[model samples]
Target: MNEAIMEKVSADPFAKLLGIQIIEIEEGKAIVSLNIKENMLNFHGAVNGGVIFSLADVAFAIASNSYGQTAVGIHVTINYMKAGMFKDTLTATAEEVSKNPKLGLYRMTIRNQDGELLATADGMVYRKKEQFA
Candidate 1:
């Protein structure tokens, strides 16, 4: 099940476009990483907030849908604590906070290669009855 979910998430076009990779994934948990590229930086020379948010969102999506149920993010809030620089690797890990039949809550932390916290996010998803199969 985990393998299938990983494969499914790996095939995400947006993730592929941003070079996001799934480092690890299991039921209710996922870790993803991305290397900060020049194109990913903002005018201030730091990684764009949207890029960081997308990395976190990918982790959340993988964790929330690990159970094979189709889940879509309904709401999310993120806080940026530090900036990511070029050539730095950013990793985001997501863990389920709570889940029911209809909804799931998740928390995500984004860190740099040095383990410095860069951002955090809380997300809610609406789980559909349909399966990923």
Candidate 2:
């Protein structure tokens, strides 16, 4: 199941475009990493909040869909706590907070290589009856 989930996430074009890498994934958790690049920086010369949010979203998507059922994000809220610098490797981890037959809630955290918290997010997804192909 993990292998299949990894394969599915590996093919995500948006994730690939942002250089997000899947570090780990299980039934209701996932870890993804990204290396800060020049293009990812904002006018303030810090990694853009969108980039951090994208990393967290990737982790959330992976964890929510880890069950092999199609899950689509319905809502998400993120809080940025720190800035990421160039060359910094950021990792985002998502874990299931709660779930039922049709909905799932996940909590995600982004941290730098030194384990400093960068951002946190909560996401909810609606599970579909269809399974991944």
Residue lDDT tens for model 1, 59-82: 999999999899999999999999
Tens digits of lDDT, candidate 2, 45-115 = 99999999999999999999998889999999999999999999999999999999999999999999999
lDDT at 27 for candidate 2?
93
List residue ranges in candidate 1 displaced over 4 A.
none
Model 1 TM-score is 0.97
TM-score of each: 0.97, 0.97
Residue 59, candidate 2: how far off, in angstroms?
0.3
**Residue 73 alpha-carbon offset, candidate 2, angstroms:** 0.1
Candidate 2 structure lDDT = 0.95
